[model samples]
Target: MDAANLDRLVDTDRVHRSVYTDPAIFELEMERIWGRAWIFVGHESQVAEAGQYFATTIGRQPVMMTRDEAGGLHVLFNRCAHKGARLVGEGAGRADKAIRCCYHGWRFGLDGRLLSIPMADGYDGTRFGKGCPEADVQPLSRAESYRGFVFASLAAEGPGLVAWLGGAASSIDNMVDRAPGGDLEVTGGVLRFEHDSNWKFFVENLNDLMHPMVVHQSSSLTARDVAKAELGPEATMPPALQIIAPFTESYRFFDEMGLHAFEWGHGYSGGKTSIHAKYSDVPEYNAAMEAAYGPERVAEIFAVNRHNTVFYPSATIKGPIQTMRIVKPLAVDRTVIESWTFRLKGAPDELLRRSILYCNLINSSANLVGPDDQEAYRRQQQGLRAEGAEWVAMHRDLGREEDLGEGHLYAKGSSDLAFRNQFRAWKRYMAGVA
Candidate 1:
């Protein structure tokens, strides 16, 4: 699409329906946004061992992240140079000393350099390897890691990861700072779920406090009732019950809490009540944090009880629970979410157990909360297909937002500030400005 069409698709307060449903716009997003943005690929803990590789995608291209023999990280396109076959299957595996293509036996090192080729004599005196860098599995233009979270950008030029993160870097810091060792690792496993809707719908819903009290009412109420039945009214609610029941909170609570929108479409919303504070106290975990970062710092870290932080078009990290959901867009109408739980190094086992329980109850495919959202998003996709509506309104407290300087916008009411902020970034990315 031309710049004129991209401008018409999004605006300050609303966006056209075709932005979510149009195939051509989706392709452009893959090219202009995903191709250039620093997209998360995997965590360093997943590939800690030498020669270990994890296959993932940057936009529509199939790519793999690997650790070399000396433990250096590399991100390369997962294609054989000889016959264009996939070098490795999807998922994690050890490449041994080198990667050998299953189709043609072309070999590559962990850093994606050409190692050797079978039947080498067949190319004798030929121009096979003459000035042919493309004959090796291609590496990404840039790859970097910040506090163990790895991201890659296909374009050669852009801001570095830290610069791109801006104020959003604090979310990553908070996640790792809670650990006594000041580190976090992706543990347990991943819950992979697919939603029959545009990927943007899922990202927008990460901080959409308005919908939880409505779309998730049935699941939240059912969970509350079950908790009341199992435990007496005077008893403390279990951590899982604490997480599931919060969706039924009043709109006033969310309004009183604030939303912080940062640059590059990254933003978060927090409530006054801390989700972790509701659970039984872990003295050991508390002591560990205190010893590592001192009492004042520990208290300050625990006080930032953010619900969810959207890392732009890819992932949503819930810092309070140490869980994240990564979105992979397959088509205009199909998207996959990989839910991950983290283990805080040097923290108590109970904290990790609570994180796993939270993932199972709210983020997993079979969970009550996730399916409710998936169904609503699917219905939205279906409704948007009809020719009745042309625009989706994002006017809740639109003109009332106060610019807090340094790319932050704040509103006093329950607002669509996050949606408008996201679309602004979307417009910039699609128009090749961001």
Candidate 2:
């Protein structure tokens, strides 16, 4: 498509439905957007010990994350240089010192260096034995880690990981800082779910403040009712369930907190509230935070209640419950969500329990709230396949976003500034620029 046509395909207020439904566009996005962007791999804690490895994908390419003998992480393509067989199978496991290919007995070091190939005499006189770098596993163009989360880019050039994270960086910091030891570790196994809708739908849903009350009404109401029955005299106006219930509160509540959108299509919305004060269900957590960070700092940490922070095309970090949902787009209408929960290392057990409960209740594949949202996304994809509608509305707060420095935009929480800022970055990346 031409630049002008692509430009017209997306507007400040609405986007053509083809952006979500077109197979060709999805393929282009996999190359232009996912290839160049710094995509989040598994956490560093997953491969904490030397020789531990986790296999994952960056864009369409299968890659593996391994720890070198020198205590550094390396991300390399999973395919073997000889015979083109995948060196490791499709899961996380230890290479036990060297990665041995099951197909041909070719062995490689933890750092993707070619070590041996069983029959050394076959090519001793040829160019194969002189230690060619080409014979080793190929490495990603860029690999970096922030705090313990690892990310890799398939393309050779782009913004650094920190620069790409932008405003969403604070969400991660807050998540780790809330822990008593100021460190976080991935404890719970990831919950993977398949969605029969475009990945963009999930991305848009992350900062969508309007749908929660309506989409999550059943769960929110149930939570409120349960809380009321359990604590007769403790019910408040904006109950704890309201936070998870999606749309329990009016737009005015979300609007007051303000939203910030950053350069790389990442954004955050929703008001800040204290979970410890709201529920009072985890006193041990509150006590640990207070002991480690003092009462004021603990209060400050819990008070920064963000709903969902989007990390562009890949990840969503929910601060309140310390939940992260990473998106892996498979096709035009297929996406896989890998949900992980973190425990604050050295914190009280109750804190970890709370995180686990939140993950189960809301973020899990079998959650009441997620299925409802998934149904909506499914119907949206079906509807978009029709011939009637051509564009999706993003007109909520058009032209209202204030320009912050370094390509950042900010507005009230209820504004659609996040969507607009996202498209701004999307257009730039899709056009193959910064």
Candidate 3:
């Protein structure tokens, strides 16, 4: 696409519907954006031992995260050097000493070096010699960890992980600090769910401050009613109510707090009220955090409430409950969401349970709040196939952005700055500029 056409395709506020519906644009996104960005992998705690490993995908490439004998982490492609069969199956497993491909008995070390192959004498003098670099399993271009979470970049060049993360790094730091030991563990099993819409729909929705109250009205209202019934008419807000309260939170509240957009399309809706205050019913969790972080730091940590922080092309970190939802794109219009709940390494067990419960209630496939939003996204993808409208409206607070250094901007919560910022990064990546 030419510059004029690309400019017309996207605007400052809203993007063209075709950006969401067109298959061609989706292909371009996969090649230019997801191919180069530092996408999130599983947490380090998931594979803590020497032989433990977890299999994941980066862009369209199948990759594995394994812990070597020296207790270091390695992220490598899953294919074997010989015969091209995957060395390990889908899902997490133990590699023991090395990954043995079931197809040809090709053994590879934890770091993906070729260890041995059965019947090796057949090609000793040929190009498939033991010393050939092609015989070793291919490793990713870059692998790095921030705190305990691991991420990998498929391309050899681009911004480093830290530079790419930018503003979103605070979200991860806040999460780790919530734990008494200043660390987190991936304790609960992942909750995988499929959406019938494009992956971008989910990413865009992360910074959508308006939808929670209206789209999730049924659940929010139900929670409100339950809170009232359980505590009586004069009773205050409850923990369960806070769980769904963001939906009913006033637009003014969002507008004042605003959203912050960073480089590479990463953005987050900021200015969240403390959910802990509403949770007088759950004194156990409050006390646990307070005891772990002490009264001052605990208050500070809880006070930095954020709705959802986007990690660009792949994941959303929900800090309040220590929940992370990783996006795996299956197709232009289909995506798989893997939800992982974390435990504060030194916190109480009840706190961990609370995080799991929130995951089930809000992020799970069976959630009452989630289906409504998914239905809207499905219809959006279907409706955008029309020929009438050429542009999507993102005109909210256009000239009102407060510029932060290093290509970051901030605007009111009601502004479309997040969407606008995303398309800017999208254009840069698609044009091979960033």
User: Can you give the TM-score per candidate against the true fold?
Assistant: 0.96, 0.93, 0.94
Cα lDDT tens digits, model 1, 246-359, are: 788788876766787888898888834533445667898898888899999988988888888888988789887899999899999999999999999999899889899889
Error of 3 at 144 (Å): 0.8
lDDT values for all models: 0.86, 0.81, 0.81
Report the C-alpha displacement of residue 428, candidate 1, in angstroms. 0.5
Query: lDDT by residue for model 2 over 194-295, one digit each (tens)?
Result: 999999989988777777667777777677667778768465534335346444666676566678888789988754642223544467777777888898
* Regions of model 3 farther than 4 Å from truth: 1-7, 229-231, 236-238, 272-277, 281-294
What does candidate 3's lDDT look like per residue over 1-434, in tens digits? 65666667765666787778778878878887888888898899989898888998987789999998999898999898888888787678898898888988888889787888788899877988476889988889999999988999888998888889997898898888878777889975788889888998888887877676688778787788777788897876554566776566677866766798898889877745533224443466567777776789877887787768898889889786789999998887888988889998767787787787788888898876778888888988787787887667778778899998777788888888887787888878877777
For model 2, what is the error of residue 113's alpha carbon versus the real structure, in angstroms, after optimal superposition? 0.8
Q: Would you list the clashing residue pairs of candidate 1?
A: none
- C-alpha RMSD in Å of predicted model 1 compared with the true structure: 1.6
lDDT of 1 at 139: 92
Clashing pairs in 3: 13-394, 14-393, 14-394, 213-247, 258-413
In TM-score terms, which candidate is top?
A: 1
